[model samples]
Target: MKIGLYFGTFNPVHVGHLIIANHFAEYSDLDKIWMVITPHNPFKKKKTLLDNHHRYQLVLEAVEEYPAIEASTIEFNLPQPNYTSNTLAHLKEKYPQHEFCLIMGEDNLRTLHKWKNYEVILKHHDIYVYPRIADSEDQTQHELLNNERIHIIEAPVVEISSTAIRKAIKAGKNCRPLLPQSVWRYIDEMNFYK
Candidate 1:
């Protein structure tokens, strides 16, 4: 089995996340796309993040109808500041039968060098990078671009962002179009981001 890991904080699962995962499941060689919910990202601030369980549930609700995508809480059990390379190593060791690939946006490619064991990640796993609206041309022209392990996929570009959604919710605005119905209902019922 081939799995593509779409790792993120997913503070609140939105349409954009679903779109990319769907595209990978349909267009890429991946049999399934797992949205690995990272409890804590070393580079991101923890204060702005929602609870891991709540965020995980939101992802589950958002992808419930889509069999091709799954919500993984793999990072929840791991140590703080969950590193991609560490998670990748653990997954590879546990599921040796499955071929694991990393799915990320082109913007992250620019900062790949900042990640822990980034070189080892590039060498071992195949990466599928989707386009980001604000990604610079120079950022995409990294040395890894020539590596066969890295693939640039033309997935749909969604302008919607989790920060925008959170702001909308705090302002008491309707953001249903930017999120799945289930997720929107959950956020509304729980009064999240208020």
Candidate 2:
């Protein structure tokens, strides 16, 4: 199987994430798009993040209707400050028959050099990059952007962010439009981010 691994904290799965995953599943050569729920991202702050299992369950709820999309808790059992390169290596060893591709936003591509063993990741896996509103299209200026393994996908942009959603919920505003119905309902029932 050819899988596109989309790694994120998710915090709470939002519609914007679903849209990107859906686009990859429908348009890309990927057989499935696995939403790898990172319990702790090396580059991000952990204080604001929701519990790993709760976040994973939210992702599972959000993508349940999509056959090609799956929520994965693979990193939960791994070591803290999950590194993409290490996770990729582990996945490759566990599933030798599967070909894995990295799915990320253009913003991440800008800082790829800062990642541990980034050269190995770049050389071994194909990276599918979607444009982010905050990122410039002229990323070709970056030396690593010239790699043939990096593919730029023109998927629809959804400006909604998980941070904004949390803020809206905290302020007693409805953020249903920014998230999947099931996810919003789950948040509402559990009173998350408040």
Candidate 3:
């Protein structure tokens, strides 16, 4: 089976996330999409993120209805400050039979060169890139585009972000429409981001 690994902190899984993952499942050749929840991202500050377990739970609720998409907590057990290259290596060892691919947005594609062992990753697995509205002016053309493994998918450009959702919740705004019903209820009941 060809599985696409969609990595994210999922501060709280929202509708935008579901749309993108679903789009990959429906639009790409990927047989399954794993929403890999990272315990800690090297680039993100922890203070704004919910606990790893809570984020995992939110993902579980967010994706439970979709058969092709599943929530994954694999990174939760690995050593802290998760790196995509390391996670991919561990996944290959754990599930050798299945073919794994990376799913990312256009914005992430811009900075792929800076990632640890990015060259190795590009050489080994296919990368499925989706459209993302860039928040800043980054005009450099990624040389990685020359690689045969990078497939640019014509998916919808989702502008919603987890950061905006968290800020809205903290401000006492009802952002339920931006999230899955179950995820919204879970966040509301747990009083997260308040």
Candidate 4:
């Protein structure tokens, strides 16, 4: 089985996330797109992050309908400031039966050089990059993605972002549109990240 690892904090899962995961699963050669709920990303700030368990649960609620879009918390058991290479290596060892590919945005692709052991990541695994609207500034990166294993997929641009959703929730504004109905209800009921 071929699986695409779609890693993200998913501060609160939304329609945009589901759209991309479904798009990849339905359109790509990948049999399933596991929404890997990254516990921590070295590049991003930790201040705004919700508890890892909450974030993971939100992803599960958002992707519950699609068996191919299940949530994974493998990173939760890894070290802090989780590195992609480390997670990938661990996953490969654990699930040797399944082929693991990467699913990321073009923005991440441009910054891939900064990641720990990026060379290994590029050399060992196949990548499926979805173009982000912001990456339009550098169209060349889309054409000149360094790795031969990389594939640039034209996924629907869902402008929704977790940053915007967090800001809205922090301000006591409604976050209905930015998140799934179940997630929104769960957040409200639990008062998460408040």
Candidate 5:
């Protein structure tokens, strides 16, 4: 089976995230897309991250309706400051029957070299990159022309961002549309990340 590993902090899984995952499932050769919930990203600030379990539950709630999309907590059991290579290695050991590929945005592609064992990752697995706001056609050209394992997917361009959503919530603005109804309700009821 071809599985695309979609990793993210998922502070609160939003509609934009669901849309991207759906697009990848629809357009790619992937049979299923797993949303890998990471406790903390090495590149991102640790302070902004939500509790690992909470984030995992949010992803579960957000992707519950999509049969093709499933939420994963593989990172939760892994070491702190989760790295892609380590997670992939563990997953390979556990599920040798399925092939796992990386799913990310063009923005992340630009910083791929900074990731641990990036060369090994690029050589071993297929990478599907969706274009973000900052990463334009030029970035796509660079990625496609430079790597044979890379595929640039044309997903929807939404201005929504997790940082913006968090800010809106802090400013006493409505975050209903930015996130899934379940996620919003959970955040409101629990007063999370405030």
Candidate 6:
């Protein structure tokens, strides 16, 4: 089984995320996409982030209707200060039978060099990159990305961000259309942003 790891904080799961994940699952060669919900780092206390479980719950609700898309809480069990390289290594060890690939935006590819053990990530796993606004500026591709392993997937450019959604909710805006119906209800009932 080939799986694409779509990593995000998912502070509150929204429609844009579903769009991208669904796009990957439907368009790409990946058999399934795991919306890997990144856990809150204890050292980096982000007041905006809901509890890991709450965030995971939102992701669960958001992906419940999509068979090809599923929510994963893998990061919650990993050691703190986890990096992408660390997660990749752990996943390979745990699921040796399944081939893992990375699903990222082109913007992340531009900054990929800065990540810990980025070379290792490039060496071991294939990267499936989607278009991003920042990707338009870099006409010349980086030398490092000149490899067969990197797949530039022309997925939809999702402009909606979780931060924007949170701000809208905090401002008492009707962000229902921006999120999955179930997630909207959860956020509303819990009074998360308000």
Candidate 3, RMSD to the unseen true structure: 1.4
The residue-by-residue lDDT of candidate 4 on 71-108, one tens digit each, is: 99999998888999999999999999999999998888
Candidate 3 clashing pairs? none
> How many collisions per candidate?
0, 0, 0, 0, 0, 0
lDDT of 6 at 189: 89
In model 2, the clashing pairs are: none
CA lDDT of each prediction against the hidden true structure? 0.91, 0.90, 0.91, 0.87, 0.87, 0.88
Give the TM-score of each candidate: 0.97, 0.95, 0.96, 0.93, 0.93, 0.94
- Answer with 3 or 4, whichever has the higher lDDT: 3
lDDT of 5 by residue, 2-46 (tens): 999999988778999999999989988999999998888887898
lDDT by residue (tens digit), candidate 6, 1-194: 99999998888888999999999999999999999988864334577789989999999999999999999999889987668899999999999999999999888887787789988998999999998887265433466467888999888888998888988988989989999999999998899988
**TM-score, cand. 5 vs. native:** 0.93
What is the per-residue lDDT of model 3 for residues 111-145, given as tens digits with 9 covering 90 to 100? 98889999899889999999877777454435677
For candidate 1, lDDT tens digit of each residue in 1-194? 99999999998889999999999999999999999999988888899899999999999999999999999998888888889999999999888999899999888887887889988998899999998886247644568788899999989987788988999999989889999999999999998999
Q: Kindly give the stretch of ten consecutive residues in candidate 6 with the minimal lDDT sum.
A: 135-144
Task: Give per-residue CA lDDT, model 2, range 1-194, as digits (tens).
Answer: 99999999898889899999999999999999999999888777889999988999999999999999999998988888889999999999999999999999888888887889989998899999998877355454266667899999999977777888889999999778888999988999999999
Candidate 5 wrong stretches, greater than 4 Å:
135-144
Instruction: Report the lDDT of model 6 for residue 133.
Output: 85
What is candidate 3's TM-score against the reference? 0.96
Off by over 4 Å in 4: 135-146
Top-TM-score candidate index: 1
